[model samples]
Target: MYDINTKRLIKTFTDMAKISSPSWGENAMRGYIVNAVKKLGVTARQFRSGESYNLLLTVRGDTKRKPVLFSAHMDTVTPCDNVKPVVSQTKITSDGTTILGSDDKAAIAMFLEGLRYNKEIRMPHGPIEILISCAEEVGLRGIKEFDTSVLKARHAFVFDSDGPVGKIVLQAPYHSTMSIAVTGRAAHAGMEPEKGINAINVLSEIITLLPASRIDHETTVNVGTISGGRATNIVAEKAVCVLEARSIDYRKLRKQEVLIRSIAKETSARFKARCAISRTLEYSGFTIHPDAVISQIAATAMARIGIRHQFEVSGGGSDTNILNAAGISAVNLSAGMQRVHTTKEYVMIRDLIKGTKLVLSIIDIMR
Candidate 1:
């Protein structure tokens, strides 16, 4: 069993929480992480990706052992400016007005502390790579744009899930995003109401024909945004709706996609309006069985740290999905984050220490 410096871990986490790292604006956070790792005598490479940079740190270890990668995002959701972490004896939270930014920061702090401990004791381990991504909250944009060819590790462990430290995400859904536009003739509402076709009405009818929210235990759909209208006194000539669908099963996801497109086409035609829809596959779904090597390593690491490991399926996507798509087997481990992406987000101090120990344990097992 490895010993974790609890005080140092807490300080590191709180310091990161104070940095404002909203999506596409993670320069400050990246700099801070680079400096922190440098203090441990480890140099990190910053790759320019989109509006931000992706930081990668490689540590040489036993060459005979397989290389392993660890990942976390540097960006946080909105309302993260001027974040003030309220650290108590039990947990760390925000000032009730802004998010605590622990969604992925907790994992970062854990990684840093684990490195410090490993260096101090010169623990036996294999080659380790840490990838800190930017703009992950926006849509996994940073990782999606990242050049995976530079990585030498084929197995990765992502620490970005929200739950206790022992929970392991075994499955994530395939995601597809859609943008639908309805076009119709416009006319004055009072002067020639019958001469116009309201695009808003046609779009509303199409939405009613679609399934939303929870489609089943493994699938979900949500209409996130809608806009279009010139004036209240005029019939709307154009309207647009943006939404997404996700499912663990690819066939089910395609079925939902086809159904949505068909309904939008049929409904718009019935209203004599033109419907244009664009759909993009954001990321493919992934599943890692319990018997897989990556899963076994995670399980063994948790067992070594006395953490009761549990398998879970997430409705959301993370860097893990993208890594798996790149042919690198990966699993997302819970970072003890609670109520993430909100002002109520918090993480337990105990879980933070446990998470750090888990990281160290995995590295030791890789030797």
Candidate 2:
């Protein structure tokens, strides 16, 4: 059993939450983390990734043991500027005006505390790598640009899931994004309404025909944004819509994608309008068996900490997906973030402490 510095852990997390790290703008948060880690006598290697940087820190240990990787992101969703974290006896929350930014910061704090504890007690461990990614909230832009060839570890653990500390995400969905642009003849609504194609109407029809919102147990789709019409008095000549589809099974994802494209093509032809469609694979899905060594190590870590382990399949993608696609076997572990991506997001103090202990335990198990 290991003792966690609960007060220090909470302070670190709260301080980090106050930093503004919106996607594609994580320089300040990256600097804060680098300084904190340096206090523990750890040096961070910076890799330029898009608008920000991805940080890597390696702790030397027994050469005979295989190295393991731990990862989290430094970016948060929007409305993160000037965040204020309110701490109570039970949990930490924002002032209801802005998000608490616990989506990934809590994991960073846990990593820092684990390193601090290890140094204080001289805990014996194997080679451990810590990766802090940038722009993860913006479609995983940072990790996508990062070169995985530089990593020495074959197995990685991502601390970015939203659940209790004991939950382990073994499966994540393949994510794909779609952009649709409908083009039609523009005409004055009052003068010649019939002469205009009203692209907005055609786009609406296409959306209605497309499958949406919880397609199945393993699949989901959503149309996130729509924009059209220059003025209220004019028939819209062009309209655009952006949506995404995700599924744990690649076949299901592909089927949904095909169905969407077919609907757009057929619908536009019927309306005598031109439709332009663009689709991109955001990231591939990943699955790690429960019997895999990484999963077993996580289970053992949780069990040793008196927590019941739970395996879960997540609908969202994280750095874990990119890592697995890059040929590294990785699993995402819950960092106790609840109601993430919202102003009401919060994390429990107990969960934070337990999560830190779990990190330490996993490191010990890998020794």
Clashes of each: 0, 0
lDDT of 2 by residue, 87-181 (tens): 99999999988999889999999999999999999998888899999999888999999999989899898999997899999999999999999
| Candidate 2: Cα lDDT at 201 | 93
**CA RMSD for every model?**
1.4, 1.8
* Window of ten residues with lowest summed lDDT in model 2: 34-43
Cα error, candidate 1, residue 282 (Å): 1.7
Candidate with the greatest lDDT versus the true structure:
1
Tens digits of per-residue lDDT, candidate 1, 170-200, equal 9999999998899988999999999999999
Candidate 1: list runs displaced more than 4 Å: none
Candidate 1 global TM-score: 0.96
Index of the highest-TM-score prediction = 1
What local distance difference test score does each model get? Answer: 0.94, 0.93
Rate residue 364 of model 2 by lDDT.
89
lDDT of 1 at 351: 92
